[model samples]
Target: MTETVAVVGGTGTLGAPVVRHLLDRGASVFVLSRNATNVPAGAEHRRVDLASGEGLGAALAGATVVVDTANSNKGAEDVLVAGTRRLLEAGAAAGVGHHLAISIIGIDQVPMKYYRAKLAQEAAIESGPIPFSILRASQFHQLLDMALSAAARFGVRPTGAAKVQPIDPDVVAARLADAALAGPAGRLSEIAGPKVQTLSELSRTWAAARGKRRLPLPVPSWGKMGKAVAAGALCNPAATTAGKDFEEWLRHE
Candidate 1:
């Protein structure tokens, strides 16, 4: 039997690749989002709003699995935690067998507000009605690049002393696709980059790869969040590691 998968936020960075992988795996794919303009070519686009819970039940109908990659930095509480609860409610009503979500590693250890929201989102999924799988991954190489690029515009790259193990989102997306196919297994093994490096080192490598000479300013992390980052709370050495590191990913970008 053919499996039907619904990918929420399917046009975003990690979500886009997940749609491609699910398509590659021959699953019937639906990209559920508020705006369908950028939805991938092969998958069907369904207009749905996670925040409002509009169109969710209809959009998720007939789906065997739902992969929630939806995220909102500005509205983390409304869109991530509450939206996840809304998604789970709709998924349950639709008789969706598996609810799969992508989360960050060490959300529990990190005291950041966004991580707290994500942790709440995970809690929602765990306590929800449907069987679920959650894949906790490290920071994405793209996220680090975005941070470095933003600081580069100011003439210097400011980096914290925090250590990060950034993984390629494409690799993370593939793992998500596999999990969507593998059924609900609860929390899966975490995923991270092959090597763990400090933010300053990642900045230096990023600058070198782009052939730009920029001064890397060292910034100290303070408070609980900073201490957690410095303690490598974002990295998982025992987790599965795959794909390009920061330098290799920069080469392609």
Candidate 2:
């Protein structure tokens, strides 16, 4: 039997690759977003906003599995937590069998507000009636690059001495697509990069790649969030590693 998979936030960085993977796996793929104009041509595009719940049910109707890679950095509460609640309700109503949500690694351990929102998002998924699987991954290489570039504007890069195990989006997307196909396994194993590199090292490498020179500044994090990140709580040392390291990714990408 053919599987119909609905991918929320399918046009975003992480979500786009998952959509591609699902399509490559021969599943009938639907990309759900408020504006799906940029969604790839191979999959069906459904314009639906999770926050408002408009067209959500119709978009998710008859889906065998739903992969939620949706996220909002500025509106984490509205999009991550509350929007997930809305998705869960709609999925349950649509008789969706498996719900696969991609989350960040160490969200429960981190003290940041965004991490807290992710925790709430997880709670909503866990308590919902639908059978669900949640996969947590470390920071993405793109995100790390963005961070380095943003900090480089000041002529110095400050990383707060946080250690990151950054993974490729395509690798993370493939794993999530596989989990969606395999059905709900509850919380699956976390995925991470091959090496645990400090933010300073990543920033320096990124700067060098850009043909720019900047001093690596190790800024101390004072609060609990700082402590957790500094302690490497965001990294899953035991998780399976995938894709190229930062240097290799930079060269190819």
Pick the lDDT winner: 1
Model 1 clash number: 0
Superposition-based RMSD of candidate 1 using all C-alpha atoms, in angstroms: 1.1
Whole-model alpha-carbon lDDT for candidate 1: 0.91
Whole-model Cα lDDT per candidate?
Answer: 0.91, 0.88
Q: List where candidate 1 sits over 4 angstroms from the true fold.
A: none
Model 1 Cα lDDT, one tens digit per residue, 1-253: 6789999999898999999999999999999988876676779999898889999999998999999999899899999998999999999999999999999999999888999999999999999999999999999998999989888988897777899999999999999999999999999999998889998889989888877787778788888989999999999999748679899999986
- Cα lDDT, model 2, residue 16: 95
Give the TM-score (vs. native) of candidate 2: 0.96
- In candidate 2, how many Å is residue 22 off? 0.5
- What is the per-residue lDDT of model 2 for residues 1-253, given as tens digits with 9 covering 90 to 100? 6889999999999999999999889899999998866688789999888777789989998898999998888989998888999999999999999999988898888888898999999999999989999999999989988877787888887755788998889999999988999988999999998889887788777877888788767788668888888899999889858588897888888
Error of 1 at 145 (Å): 0.6
